[model samples]
Structures are given as C-alpha cells and as structure tokens.
Target: MNIKTEFSDKTLTAIIEGDIDHHTAKGIRETIDLAVEEKNPSALTLDFGNVQFMDSSGIGLIMGRYRLMKLLNGNLELVNLPEHINRLISLSGLFSLDIIKNKGCEQIETRE
Candidate 1:
C-alpha cells in the first residue's frame, strides 16, 4: 500500500492507495501514525479514493486512527471512500463514520 501524507495549517491529509487488507493495514497505520506524531495536526483526513479493495482491516485502521486522534486531542475525518469501503464501514456500526464531514462520497477527485 502507498500512503502519502501532507501537512498544512495543522491538518494532515493522507492519500492512501492499494488494498487495505491484513497485509497492508499495519504498515499503512504505522506510516500514518508516524506522520501524526511528527506533524501533531489538529485534524487528520484519510483519503481513500485510490483504494481498489479493502477488508475488515480497513475498518480497524479507521477505528485505531480515531482513537489516536482522540488521545491527541485532535479529530479524524474520512474522505474519498469507495462505495464498497463506505458500505463496509457503515455496516460495522461505527456511528462516527457518518459524522465525518466528507464521508459518503463514492469518490472524490484528487490532484494526482
């Protein structure tokens, strides 16, 4: 998986590509958490526009990040979620998922 992170105005944006399955979730989470520590952003946005596949691991990734952001007194947001990924998260009964300002977009355009 590829996770490219950008920080600006105290917000961190992670553009994730590739499948977010058991094999890649840990690496992706580590990379994002490392960036979170380094940037200490007030908000972190996970962009999943390029993700072609995902599993329960993806939900775990989001949940873990949510906890991390809470511990840091920051906020976590999700965007550009593919339809399947959106459905997965919704079915997981993660109420916070719907609160994300940018959630439910079948796909969001990216500069790249």
Candidate 2:
C-alpha cells in the first residue's frame, strides 16, 4: 500500500492506496505512526478512496490507530470507504468511532 500524508496543525490526513492486508499493513503502520509522531497530530483522518482490498489486518490497523489517538486525547476518522469496506468496518464495529464520505478535500469533524 502507498500512504500519502498531509498535515494541518495538529491534524493529519493519510490517503491510503492499494491493498491493505498482511503484506502491506506493517509498512503502512510504520509510516503512518512516524508521520503522526513527527507532526504531533491531535487528530487523524484516513482516506481509503483508492484502496481495492483489505482483510482482518486492516481492522487491526484501524483499531491500533484508534487506541493511539485516544491516548493522545485526539480522534480518528475515515472517509471514501466503498460499500464493501463500509461493511467490513461496520461489522468490525468501527462506526462508533468515525466514518465520513469523501467530498473533495472537505474538512470532516473529529469524532470521539
């Protein structure tokens, strides 16, 4: 997977592309974590517009980030999720966190 990160003050957005499975989850995790720390972001937004496939590892990644954000007194949000991805996230009960639709770089509200 490829991760493109953008930061605005204490908020960081990560645009993720490609498949998010065991093969790519580690790299994504490391890259995103480093960026979050370097930026000291108080909120994280994940964009999955270009992601084609994901498995349980993707769930793990999201959960891990959620935990990290909570520890920092921040929040996590997701956008551009396709129907299948939305199903997975809902089944995994990630909706209680944050889930938004992509609308041309819109600034989504942070979720607790």
Candidate 3:
C-alpha cells in the first residue's frame, strides 16, 4: 500500500493507494499516527480513491483513527471511497462515527 499525507493547519488528509488488508494495515496505521502526532490537525480525512481492495483490517484502522481523533477532540472524515469500500464502511456502521463528506471527490464542510 502507498500512503501520502498532506497537512494543513486544521486538517490532515491521507491519500491512500492499493489494497488495505492485514498485511498493509499496520504500516498505514503507524504512518498516519505519526503524522497526526506531529501535525496535530483538527480534522483527519482518509482519501481512498486509489484503493482497490480492503478487508476487515481496514475497519480496524478506521476505528482506531476515530478513537485517536476523538481523544484529540477532533473529527474524522472519509473521502473518495469506492463503492465496495463504502459498502464495507457502511456495514461497519462507521458513518455514525465519522463524516462521509464525499465519495471519490474533494472534502466539503458539513457544518456551518
């Protein structure tokens, strides 16, 4: 998997590529965590436009990030999710916890 991160004053966006499974989850998690710790963004966005496959481990990664963001009193958002990955996220009930600002598109503010 390939992970690229962009940091702004209030947001950290991760552009993820390739499959997210047991093998790739650990590295992705660590990378994002490190960035979060260093940048301290108020929002975290995971862009999955280039991702092709995901498994249960993906859910774990999202959940972990959600918790981390909550601990920082921030928000977690998902963007550019493919259909199958969206289905997985929905089935995991992640939308209740994080914002799905866009699907395969740029992020938008959900609140005024």
Assess each prediction's global lDDT (C-alpha) against the native: 0.85, 0.83, 0.87
Candidate 3 regions with alpha-carbon error over 4 angstroms: 103-112
Q: Give the per-residue lDDT digits (tens) of candidate 3, residues 1-112.
A: 4999999778999998999999999999999999999999999999888898999899999999999999999999988887787778777888787488775463332333
Ranking by TM-score: 3, 1, 2
The TM-scores, one per candidate, come to: 0.87, 0.85, 0.88
lDDT of 1 at 74: 87
Compose the digit string of candidate 1's lDDT tens values, residues 1-112. 4889999999999999989999999899999999999999999999988899999999899999999999998888888777787678767777555535545575433333
Query: Highest lDDT, which number?
Result: 3
Instruction: Report how far off residue 83 is in candidate 3 (Å).
Output: 0.2
List model 2 lDDT by residue over 78-107, tens digit each.
778766777777678777765554455434
TM-score of 3: 0.88
Q: How accurate is candidate 2 locally (lDDT)?
A: 0.83
Give per-residue lDDT, candidate 2, residue 23.
91
Q: Local error of candidate 3 at 73, Å?
A: 0.4
Top candidate when judged by TM-score against the true structure: 3
Candidate order, lDDT descending: 3, 1, 2
